[model samples]
Target: MAIDRQTVNRVAFLARLKIDDDKIEATEEEFNKILNWVEQLNEVNTDEVEPLSAVNDLPLICREDNVTEGSQADKILANAPMAEYGYFVVPKVVE
Candidate 1:
């Protein structure tokens, strides 16, 4: 399908792109090429193909969800600019 200059302009507007007047012709040509390539893909037969969720067939490796170390509250709050009662203190935003 041949994409027109107006269609290219509308597409640019929808996509929030600023295409110069001189670039409209080039943009339209590129858009039409893309559309033609997509149209060509329509001719491919995928009747026997199965849809796959992931490209890799390997199972995902997971680690045990257990704490290896004890609590270090002082160490954690050491870098804080302002900490109050074992928690980070920030400027209140609500009036």
Candidate 2:
């Protein structure tokens, strides 16, 4: 797909990218290169190939979920600067 200067400019604007007038041609070339690569990928035959999430055939290892954290209110709030009624207190920001 051929990308024009107007399309490049629109993309840059939408992405909040600051593109110089001199760099517009370079940006357009990069876009064209990316599109060409995608076109090349479209030419590949993947009809018989199975879709995979990972290339390596490694099994996902998971541990049993246990109660590691004990419910000790005083111990947990020991280092807190301001804590009251089983909660951490913070400075009021809103009026």
TM-score of 2: 0.46
Score residue 18 of candidate 1 by CA lDDT: 98
Model 1 Cα lDDT, one tens digit per residue, 7-74: 98898899999999999999888887888888987798889889878999999999899988769989
Among the numbered candidates, top lDDT falls to 2
lDDT of each: 0.90, 0.93
Q: Give the local distance difference test score of model 1.
A: 0.90
* lDDT of each residue in 1-95, candidate 2, tens digit only: 89999999999999999999999999999999999988997788999989889989999998889878788999999999999999989999698
Taking all chains together, each candidate's TM-score versus the true structure is 0.47, 0.46
- After superposition, the stretches of candidate 2 with alpha carbons farther than 4 Å from their true spots are 45-95
Off-target runs (Cα >4 Å) in candidate 1 are 46-95
Clashing residue pairs in all predictions, respectively, total 0, 0
